[model samples]
Target: MNKTVNQKAWFLVLPVLLLVAFSAVIPLMTVVNYSVQDTFGNNQFFWAGLEWFEEMLNDDRMWGALGRQLMFSGIILLIQVPLGVFVALNMPKKGFWASFCLVFMSLPLLIPWNVVGTIWQVFGRVDIGLLGHTLAALGIEYNYTSDPFAAWVTIIVMDVWHWTSLVALLAYAGLQSIPDAYYQAAKIDQASRWKVFRFIELPKMMGVLMIAILLRFMDSFMIYTEPFVVTGGGPGSTTTLLSIDLVKMALGQFDLGPAAAFSLMYFLVILLISWVFYTVMINLDKREG
Candidate 1:
């Protein structure tokens, strides 16, 4: 006889479902409404019928911002993943030191994002900041406000400093889950460290690594506050990612139609890329299992 599945479990999740609908679905519907219509003063809206989307698609400024966003996400992934893995590998496996390291690694993740940005903002000032003063004292003319390259580097470095710990903690947890038997077997086989890592540790950590990649990619792709606080999309739009440009259009230029269209497109891009990452992770799990 086939056992009947419990239908009562749905009751437990009904509230959560309602909450999501209230918060996410409602806001998304509002954005969709805004995207498809044009608004004039006095809260008047008229049928626009994809006009704003077409305009946004044709805008070179939007495309440039997209390029910058992609580049930043790519660079962040490249740097953070490897560096985080290295830190995880080097951490003490178990001890007081291991506990200390764990706490230390978590500190950066605990700091508020806006606060982190504010700290960096002050920390990078040319005259008052330690970094800027030291660079200046060393005879290097480094000014983020006036220099595009410096601004980019500063933001990239600041992001790495703040988020690499997250990657490291995730990788470390993955490493901890590996059985000691694997390492012992590798040692018995006279395997070199590189060989063991390549054959064993890397595969074991692949699941968490994919997760780290997905989280970092999504976060970096949509990053706004930190860079905005640090650079204000400045040095002449050199650091102006898509989110920054969208805000500027929405609030600064008061182009609500275009901003709404831009937001929907941005949401779609993130959803599509995240789905890809999720698909890859699932396939990897199947292959490994």
Candidate 2:
């Protein structure tokens, strides 16, 4: 019953493993090293142990940024998931229009993150931007640079515009995978639209929906470039999420030790929350299954 294993497959993957080590592992190790030690210039470093971690933990600014980060991520999920699913439900399931719709839906996701930010930054300017000028013409006091609420709304809208298409596309794929027989059966059973969705489509889409939720959650939680470019964490740090704050600490103030420590904590927070989301969704899927 003993057959020789194909150990040679490892050779094919070795390059990828090496690439990952060089690209991700090495940089991670450097961050870890920086996090635990303090430097006083002249290429000198001294052990700081967990002092930076403690300081970061106690810092109110970090806490505020974390709160805003969590709030932003939560809002993104709440809005994007439902909207995406609804869009998927309404999208043409087949034919040329379906192909066109797919291409159109993909347009936003195709743009680079920084480019999306820049586009929004210009688009939201009150003096010249179409949206801003129209709002101004209507006497709407919309100023993202000066008003915290407006800044939050603009970023949220921007994110929704940018990422909801991803969720819709995923959901659409899930819908496509469902057997047409199920719809036929539902029709024969005199099932209502809501009933068919609840009893058939929704359950079938659950796996992909979970994926969409997790992806959106992680992306939103770690969001940086777009909001940073659009709002620059302005209106008195009202929109200063964790990533922006981390960059400021690391580069703006050159607090390397603390910044490194903060980054590690940030990584941990993302990892932990992602794990929780994955676990909960898996359990829910299992229960439904």
| Candidate with best TM-score | 1
The estimated TM-scores of all candidates read 0.96, 0.93
Candidate 2 on 94-194: residue-level lDDT in tens?
99999999999999999999999999998999988888888999999999999999999999999999999999999999999999899999999999999
Q: Write the per-residue lDDT of candidate 1 for residues 125-238, one digit (tens) a residue.
A: 988999998999999888999999999999999999999999999999999999999999999999999999999999999999999999999999999999999999999999
Q: Each candidate: what lDDT?
A: 0.94, 0.94
**Which ten-residue region of model 2 has the weakest summed lDDT?**
36-45
Off by over 4 Å in 1: 1-11
Residue 288's lDDT in candidate 2: 70
Which parts of model 2 have CA positions greater than 4 angstroms off?
1-13, 280-289
